[model samples]
Target: MVFDVVCIGHLAKDRIVRGSEEYEAPGGACYYGSFVLRALGLRVAVVTRLAREDLPLFEELDSIGVSLFPVQVPETSGIENIHPDPDSDRRICRPRGFAGGFRAEDLPPGIEARLFYLGPIMPGEVPLDFLRHVASLGPVALDVQGILRRLRDGELVIAPREDQGEYLKLATYLKADDVEAKALSGVSSLEDAAPLIAAQGPREVVLTHREGVLVLADGEFHRFPFKPRSLAGRTGRGDTCFSAYLGRRLLGDPPREAARFAAALTTLKLERPGPFRGSLEEVTRLLASP
Candidate 1:
């Protein structure tokens, strides 16, 4: 079967903070990307490994008819973030045991994924070589938080990588936030950052800030700015963005259309607490308005 979006990597139990308030939400590219795509009425699949303790999450996905190519590991991984304000900004602290070390053998079979998104929660878990192999199977989308970070002074922070020169060469659709772009590409303008990012290898690159998302690829550039909605929760905004974008793109939507739809999907998700909470109706309304 053909999959609209196949998300790789691990899941996390996230401690979400908006201002002084805190809550836990389920995280992992698998959940976020697949959930939003399914919500959009598309075929979605997950190729991942989590602890057996997390089996219930799989059962939950299965009941909804979301296809799963599951692998079991001994433990589940976790992460914590402190959002300093309601402005939707955050600082993250990762626990040592987060769940994404995907062996190629562990990946599920008999499917061709059209769009592959890899959200690596831990640095060095999904090797660049492994990603290149995966991309050969499809167009790859990535959130580089995993590789762009390092353990510094015992805190999880974005630091320069000694080995990024090659991994950047393998990515197709790349995404990063303000801080992440600063760390990963060393440029301030997301568009200016795109050429540098593409110089590394991706055919398309985007930089997202609290204000909006920017896309540059195939010799074209575009930006989508949101009107800053008051959110119920925005724990998985970027994940939702990447997921929805891939979903639309796989459906043959143009890049600008795909990116705008993704931005709308994420804006709606910002009003919810978890992955899979936003719907197509919600995403459409946001996408249609001026």
Candidate 2:
């Protein structure tokens, strides 16, 4: 069946540490983003690689009506996120396990979507050639961080993409946090970087930062401030924003409107853990408020 969005990436088993508390949770761009899309009532499918032992972690997705096509591998890509403060987006990232890269053949035959979201959690996880093939299938909403993030000396580092133009050209909508945007364009600010990234080819660029989200589309720039009560669920902020924004876009909201809706929706997600559980009415209410 054709889906609204097909999320392609590794399903991660993340080890999250906040002060004295620590726990293992399902993460990765695909893991968090697909959940948000599905929760928004979009028809979502996930294509990911993970070990059989870790397959149980996907039960939440299955229960939520998300169609998951998981490829069993020797390992599941993962990371250990060290949060010094429980309410901070800042964290120390360490490489844990890597399932490996995806190939074109890994995509199920005849599966299709109106939007393809590349959610790779590490550089090279979704090979360039594979991404090119997905672009042929539909408009791509990409999380640029995965392709630009690398494991260096056991720490997570950003490596500027030498062929940023190629990837940007293939994507219809692109997402990056301020750090990733700076690394990609060598610009200190998102205002400067968003336009540069958009020029490469994505019609829309979603640049998220501490204060809020910046959306650049059709030569116009829009900013939406986030008002989360707390940052308890900061880990998936980027994933949540990108998925919710694209979901709203596909549902017929304009660029600026979509960005606002995403910011409000993500604000609620940040107050809790896992995917967003708030009702659509709640988000609509938040969007309508001053």
Candidate 3:
């Protein structure tokens, strides 16, 4: 079957710390984003690399009907996230494991997809040439976090790339949070950066900030406020937003409507811990709520 989206990245074994409580769980943008896409009733496939022992952690994706194409490696990549406050944005990021890198040849041939999502956890996870090759296959949706994140003395740090313009040109839809936007575009304000980021190349640039989501499309900016009652499930906020937005666009929703739907769905997702488990009806109801 032709998939609606094909996500490429590493499936991570993440150790998350919220205040004094800590637990290990499955993570990585591809892990969360693919699940949300499937839940939204889209045909999704994930191409990932992980250790043999970590392969079983993907059972949830199998149960959800997402096609998994994995590359066996020595160890599963991982991250250690320490959230100082459960409700605050500040956190310490450290690399737990490096799963090794992937090449374009690793992708299964003839796998058709409407959108190719790049969800690498760190720089070089997916190389620039590989990213460009995938863009030739279909519209590409990029999560800038992966490209900008680098290990500095074992700590995850946001590193800007000099080839930002070239990378942006390969993405049809680009998703970046406030921090990532500043790091990549060198603009401190989303208000000032969204347009500049769009001008760099993505047909639409979606920037998520504390206030809401800002989308630049067709020379106009549309803002949507997140109405989630809590930030309980904040870890995958950007992943959820980008996946849902791209799914909506593929299903023929206008750019503005897609952004709104994505924001509403993400706000709801932020209220829970895992990938969006809610149905389309639930998200619709939330979007309908005043």
Candidate 1 TM-score versus the reference: 0.91
Question: What lDDT tens digits, residue by residue, belong to model 2 across residues 159-194?
Answer: 787887788789999999999999878898899999
Please report, as a residue range, the 10-residue window in candidate 3 with the lowest summed lDDT: 120-129
Can you rank all candidates by TM-score, best first?
Answer: 2, 3, 1
Question: 42 in model 3: Cα distance from truth in Å?
Answer: 1.2
Predicted structure with the largest lDDT when compared to the true one? 2
lDDT score for residue 56 of model 3 = 86
Candidate 3 per-residue lDDT, tens place, 1-290, comes to 48989999998999889888898889999988987788778999999989998888879999999999998889889999888998886788898888877887789989889889988886678778888889889899998887888778978988788887788899999999999999877889998989888888899999987657988988888889888888777778888888888888888988899999989988888888878888888888988888
Model 1: clashing residue pairs? none
Worst 10 residues of 1 by lDDT: 226-235
Give Cα-based local distance difference scores for all models: 0.73, 0.88, 0.86
